[model samples]
Target: MHLFSALAVISVTVLQAAAHGYVPLLRINGKDVPGWDISKDPYTTPQPLRVVRGTKLDSGFISDVTSPDITCSIGNQKLPPGPIQATVAAGGTVQVLWNTWPLGHFGPVLNYLAKCPSSDCSTFKGDTGAPWFKFQQDVFSNGVWASDTLARNNYTYNVRIPSNIAPGSYLLRHENLALHAASSQGGAQFYPGTFILTPVSPTTPFTELSLVCIQLTVTGGGSLNPSGLSFPGVYKATDPGILFNVYRGDAANQVIL
Candidate 1:
């Protein structure tokens, strides 16, 4: 209740807000679809229609690298998927829209896809043991961090759907790794977005990454299963990509990054 204490809380709140964000909209097939609107969804009698999976998010992430959350968003593993699913060609594109991204959060952007074995993305929760293949990534290029580009571009990025994958329901896992505070052992910040696709695509307690799930169904004649890395098992706290300091002013230190 003290003035100084209240001011300290305010400052920390702003800092955390500056550090992370979430997917609020998605562009599919040239049409824009609203993503989860955390503010209005809780009170609506019928949830908003969307392709992106429904999730309650904050400036939080899974730092343990071993938590199931690494598979999707925080606590997303337990939430039911959205009621709608978008369809696209196997080789289409989806534009992810971040609610907000601060220039201060600098790092890499990665994309992964995993197929839903049951063919029903709504019922499929790609948590532990799910095979996720890394299909796209934008790391440091031309002496600029991917996050920098994301912020510069209004926090929007386009992700290409794989053309060679089989037709089926899938989960797309999109991510952004913020290394701005990576000097310490557990200072990495990761933002992940999950999308369901017919062609495509945790545990941890650490506030290390932000993630979202998107629902998609792919329809096309293509078949090629991609070898993948499982979440939780995919990242480790000691890994150079998750723990090294980017302030040293150098290129990325690890491949997993």
Candidate 2:
């Protein structure tokens, strides 16, 4: 079976949300690893053990498609737990936990994998070049859109590591694009917005954040580096995928992946 395809199509389903959300926890092989704790990490000296590459604050996002923050999240360069942690077998699932998701903001959920050069993720920055490979994508259908994932699964979006990829240390990038306000240039959230979450059939426009990364090590997989796409170079502000009316229809053929 294609590892990521099953869970990748699913997204977070939330209710009673406010503005936006962020990644704060991850489940690797069933173990709940604390992501960057936006609420307590800053104040707590000797910061607690965090597994995922975390942003400074919780429940935030980015609107600029050209910004490097789109690669991961702001202030999310690198973090401790270095020398490899958060290991998962190939074909396993890592649950990305979004603290809060706006009921209005809706779009496709995506996941990428960039194997750290030299097998060390601490020094490798994933912002530039085409090192990031699109492995796990959502709703590859017509008119289907951002999903009701979290509400059904306890606020966690499940990302299954592709079984065919090589085993090594990788930076797992998780993102949810909010295209509710994307009718104009630069309004889409690579990093939040409004819209319907149900999957619509036939005609419609398509779509950001809830962008975050985790330093992950994959074991028991084949050897292969998939071709990748750059972040800032991936989505253009004017591109139909980024600029379009969600209520009307999608530009990327309504293919929410």
Candidate 3:
């Protein structure tokens, strides 16, 4: 009887695996490290996007929502946390896709949190600061928690890669101010992890070999800028190991642009 049960379980597991067909998944919890990249195309004046070598990219979101649909909402979300590794030649327009998640889960507190530290509510931090004052305002200043995120499954935004971005590698950070929370008590409160983006590239399409990996990190720290705080500056990787250092341009004749 026990053997039969075990066989039955194995059969079910195989069936489930077959049904899913080994779908590709991206994690949001800072584990399961992953990456991707882009390359240059020579056919047109404006280059076509190509996957560069040795590049890793990461994506993330701010809310605590764990529903299947909620998790799906984060898939391919744009800007900081989403994929942004496409190549454009000199003086070309680069179109990008950015996804936004629903906002209802955050409730009425959204307005207040959006403009936090405005001499109104208190703030705090997540992994560092105290509880009561863990959150601040400037954190979400870069983003407008518009209404659409609260309504649908997918929110898309179109953007152009600036021509002036140069040819060097860059990192994009998407911060979703999920909520406010304190550490212990009367300590501090800050937002939660939302989204992140990393850029990597190797050699150009014409070059021999190039590798690039994009790294993205999302944190709860806002613009509370203290006198002695150690911020590597916003959009910068706090640690060198997590840094996305995908070099651009040709291999032998590469320019740090």
Candidate 4:
């Protein structure tokens, strides 16, 4: 017989009972689950699966369950020693790399965002169209993560930090990273990290600049107010989202602190 499981939109946390060969049907805000299938058997123990929650579906988020052995890192970069600097000049690319151990079978779900920490992001509210910068995924090679088939073997992300992204200390929030193979079990996890985009004087290309560490916060005035910035920043279901490697000159940079 085919078994089915469903969760309602009550103010309670959704939990699954321990069982074998059980399938899950995801329902969002009373509407049909756009890209989900119960018979497809997407649920997996010890694997990471992307799940959305909230009453009005206004709260968009990525929930991740930690894997037994999971890890992450940011590609090398040269950030300035200070907190603020000029934005990365126009026409520049940064390389961000991710290394997941024990490589699984399922690919990771990736998300990226850039926000300033201090004072609510209300200044440039509704300026979602700002050409702040651009980040692109480079590659997801399968060598570095061979030990863990679930891990991202090898990958590269190339992003160009646009020159118009007003000069300020920004937080590049990248999350929702799931490994393959672990998709059906219980290893869908959030690979969240922050990158500092310091806009410095474009006098000369500063290579190997030191990066300063800072906390990330986006209160958005109150609970009802949404952080006024393009969210989840950049998203990718299979490959890395944003690359943070800095080559030279003025450009956005990222580091794990």
Candidate 5:
């Protein structure tokens, strides 16, 4: 009887842990940045908006691209600005760390950045209205994205910041689409993510005061595509990026845009 009780407890614990997955930590240039930590209830933090969790859409609005929940899932509330900010230079890399990832949930990993109206991005609210640009996206390579690579190996994903992005404060959004069960409509699992503050500045070349003016902007002349698509607007129910069959092993045909 005791053994059966222990087994039941173990099952419940596992289920509870797998109930949700989120990026609890973020790193820039190999150093940890101030971000959400799901281990401590994110709701209690100053940046509650940075704690939105994923939803199980096996039977619900998984295929509904027009739904507001499609942006970051339902029940996700916006909070006041966070006290911390991630300072990054254009053309640098940022690493995202997930708390836990379930096995077999394979699909693409996408990143977007939305410039804030003012210098303080922490004051931004809601998932819509803010036009976001697709700065970084990884599609099916070798029949899989970061899902299999991150789940089986490392839980951290390194993404490069756009080299052409103008210096400003913006909100960085990341997502993981689990398509293991996406063979049919509404079978896909959407893990919409929390938004973090990203303040971009030019990378200084030298510490000398005389060189400061010359390095006021990113060295490279590259420019980010100004045209952007809204989250709910960027995706459609029939769009190839949204609806795909990963199990068929035809990753080369997968849609990335």
Candidate 6:
């Protein structure tokens, strides 16, 4: 009886460990930023490693894409703006450090930026109406995406701020999608993200800017809907990007958009 109890405990412990991991630290231009305490509050308590099962759908994966939790997993309420965390030039790089990501979770990494109307985002309240632009995305390349690459190497993700982005105080959002179990609908695990305030210097160029959009449509279907895609609005349980098989070794089967 004792041996059986020990085995059960081991299984529970392993399951718990697999369900939790988060980005505890953030850096810009190689310098650590402040305000991680505020950013991590929505996901877990007591500062670090605050991992919850999150909102799950029928298939036991995170599927509440329309919830406010989809945006930083923090409820969409006005948060008292805190101190400015870090400042960098428009073309600088931001690095995100995760506590620990399980090797079994393999998928892509994406980053988005939303400019605040105020000069200092530290004073801006939580408003979900801000327009966000995709600044960086890592798709499957050479048999690996950002998550796969991070699993083999370091726990840090580096993102370069667009040189043409307008100088302003902005909120940066980083996301990681673990599709290891996404073969069925609603099985994709999503680590939405936390927000960080970053002020961009005006020295960089902004006039010469161009926008490009790639629309992918399945063989028999019409163009994929690209309009009205907010963080909480863009993803749905039935979207091809959310329901895919990544273990098949075929890059086409795994959509990273």
Cα TM-score per model: 0.78, 0.75, 0.25, 0.28, 0.67, 0.63
Model 1 Cα lDDT, one tens digit per residue, 52-73: 7655444343335566656765
Worst 10 residues of 2 by lDDT: 8-17
Q: Where is model 2 more than 4 Å wrong at Cα? A: 1-19, 57-64, 78-84, 140-144, 186-208, 249-253
Cand. 5 Cα-lDDT: 0.46
What are the per-model C-alpha RMSD values against the true structure? 10.8, 7.2, 23.1, 21.4, 15.8, 16.5
Worst 10 residues of 6 by lDDT: 2-11
lDDT of 5 by residue, 40-143 (tens): 54335333433223222222223344555555443333334343356778887777776666666666566766665666554453357636666666656665
Q: On residues 129-235, what C-alpha lDDT tens digit does candidate 4 reach at each position?
A: 32222232222333222112223324323334344334333443222222222112121222112111111333311111001111123221222211332322222
Best by TM-score: 1
Report the lDDT tens digits of candidate 3 across residue range 127-180: 122111112111111232222332232332212223322343222221232221
Off by over 4 Å in 3: 1-85, 89-100, 105-144, 147-153, 179-231, 234-257
Kindly list the per-residue Cα lDDT of model 2 for residues 1-257, writing each as its tens digit. Answer: 22122332102212212245656677776788877656556467675655566454432445555677667655556344444458888899998877776555556677888888877776667888878777877743443454444534565788989888889888887777666655544233332211222223323333544566678889998877785577666766565555556676444354333
Candidate number of the best lDDT: 1
Point out where model 6 deviates above 4 Å: 1-19, 34-63, 76-81, 122-130, 186-229, 252-257
- Give the distance in Å from residue 158's predicted Cα in candidate 2 to where it truly belongs: 0.9
lDDT of 6 by residue, 1-257 (tens): 11001101000122332243444456665666532332335345432321111211111223345655555443222333343435666667766666656665666666666565665554333225535566577767776666767666677777676665565566665666655555554222332222111112333211100010111111122222111225555556555555556667564434632
Give the C-alpha miss distance for residue 196 in model 4, angstroms: 24
lDDT of each: 0.62, 0.60, 0.20, 0.22, 0.46, 0.44
